[model samples]
Target: MQDLRTVLSSDTIIIGDGAIGTMLQSRGLVAGTMPEAWNSERPEDMLAVHRAYLEAGANYLTTNTFGANRIRMREGGLGSDVAGTVERAVALARQVAEGQAWVAGSVGPTGRLMQPLGDLSLAEAEDVYAEQIEALIAAGVDLIVVETHHDVEEAGAAVRMARQLGNLPVFASFAFNPRGRTMMGLKAADAAVAMEALGVSAVGANCGDGPEAVAKALEQMHGATDLPLLARSNAGIPQLGKDAVTLWDIEAAAMAQHAQRFVSLGARIVGGCCGTGPSHVAAIRAALL
Candidate 1:
């Protein structure tokens, strides 16, 4: 409901809500299940998550639509009704937002790879992104965030589609490896430059190994572009659990160290990725001020 671009461009630091999937898990979401299903199947539970983040002082809440596109939703058995899926997700967040905070439509990478590498072509990928983002715009999202995107072309297509299909601003952030390069070999600065060229309102990093790594990635993004930067790191370094799946252990105070560092480095937006919650966001928000 608010203008994210104006708020973020000002002296204020925008704090985003932390991990949606992890929070859903704590509320009875089973492992390997699609989190977006809660939008329709468990709207109340989804609203609870949004309210928690807002109560904890998040200025921006992302809708649970990261995987609400046609191909990914169908793969996770969340149905191929992309429009209905995103509309419901935005509605759920808007219900809790109540005009007090802004809602960002969460768009992640499609699980598929683009052609010359994978089967999908840039044009084909554009169609998928257009469908997903169009739904978010029509549903009245305050902004569109294309996050954790690895492929330069894929991210470009998403940013471009958002610009063409919606009047809302778009921010693109990449998920970088420990070495500060994306899975597709684009560096953080390169990613920022690439996205800025496509008219993204902001560019930065997210879903990295942890805060330390994310700080490094954001530092890399500096000096390449003057656009506002965002950083949504994992709570801590992911550790292998007994199930052999990666888990996070970054505490609220644990994020404080890197949170300050990110602000000092010019990050306009700061929050957590996997293994984060309201506590983590509260810490980051407090540290930012």
Candidate 2:
């Protein structure tokens, strides 16, 4: 119930909620369909996911608006009402949180790359994130989490926009590959320092290969900056299961052990990514306790 900044400054190890896309998939959501659309069409499912995490003892519940930017919404047939859609997603999380947890507005990368590598310009990138972040703030989210970004500049764009929009805190999290680098080949230490320079509330790695790779990245990041760090790794590399169901390599107990390791490595906040659920969060809560 304390402000996120105050909680972070204290000795409490904050536990953030786990994956939304993967959890929705398990609840009969078809792959490749816009999950954010469920914000209206299937509010019960969204509420269930939020409730599960809150009951599992998550200090933060990240809203289900990761790909809610204008470009992705229009491309995915969800139209261009970015503000309305984002407000709806935040409402879903708030209904479940009920003042017991902080709702973090989730902003992910646009599927395109910036100039020299791709056509999207920096100004355009800022504009794209500006729209989504503005909606999140208007909807009264506690903070903005620009997560799962591979491009540092793109993440910085989100952070810059969020800072300009309001006083709400912003956390920038990047996704890393097994070699401890982003898809764009940025090392963890460099990404941490870059995001720190942008004045993010926290810099972290998420949805990477798994806990081992994430822990390694956090280790490098801890050495580079004095800012608070977060770690939200995937359960593990996903695998195909019977009936075409997706599965991950690491189990809940394994994830719990890594949760402890993340804190030991200087992550002030910890949680799961793809292939995690309430059980994983519950296990993390137990371990952290």
Candidate 3:
């Protein structure tokens, strides 16, 4: 597969894989279990998820390491082998990629808040990000993705670590509330501009209310920077189902409709987030066509 940088340089619209957690849930992942643990315990299932997305037309295969950082893993009682888990996750993604797609090392925010609001300091946050990023780089990922972050500072730390570690492309994306701002009240345009200053390859929104909310965020971000934008919205608002299961309101066709608008708004990457599945990814691929 072409390097993500080369792919981005072309006019091709990239399709990122849909929700890993959602797919795992469908495959019998227990609630509150750190999904990253499955990297070692249930490798076959992880590969299956990657294969489904690739078959559905995802150009970027995101690893199942979103919460694989040291602090989060330790807090979740998943042990101290951050690099081990990350390497396994990347290996699973690569096994499925087979050079047909780029393996993106997924680095999500530390669950803790930074100083003045929470105990974790910026310096400490960078250290946490450093460990996971080091593992990602060592494991041969094509790029790093700092995603689903609410705080720009926290996401910046991950971006900074990835940049400090290597020359791979780093894409930073935030989660927005319905009001078009981060949960921290940071505006979409402001977040995009800030990430741009951090030298991210692309900046945009992910895992918000639904496609319309993500579309609004991309519309705001489109005017803020020259960087490529990514839009990975949830299938829709979450609703409670029987047996404590969570369901999304939007259907595949509906999410695909907004995906078309995302491309028109300058989004170079588009896909689904929470509650989305392979069907949703296939719909997005079709919509882009």
Query: Against the hidden reference, what TM-scores do the models get?
Result: 0.96, 0.98, 0.98
Residue-wise lDDT of candidate 1 within 78-196, one digit each (tens)? 77899999999999999899898899999998999888889989998899999999999999899999998999999888899999997888989999887888878888888888888
Encode model 3's per-residue lDDT on 127-195: one tens digit a residue. Answer: 999999999999989999999999988998999999999999999999997778988888999999999
Candidate 2 colliding pairs: none
Ranking under TM-score, best-scoring first?
2, 3, 1
Could you tally the backbone clashes for each prediction? 0, 0, 0
How do these models rank on lDDT, best leading? 2, 3, 1
Between candidates 2 and 3, the one scoring higher on TM-score is: 2
Q: Which model, 2 or 3, shows the larger lDDT?
A: 2
Over 219-251, each residue of candidate 2 has an lDDT whose tens digit, in order, gives 899999988899999999998989898989888
Cα RMSD, each candidate = 1.5, 0.8, 0.9
Candidate 3 local Cα displacement, residue 251, angstroms: 1.5
Q: What is the lDDT of residue 242 in candidate 1?
A: 85
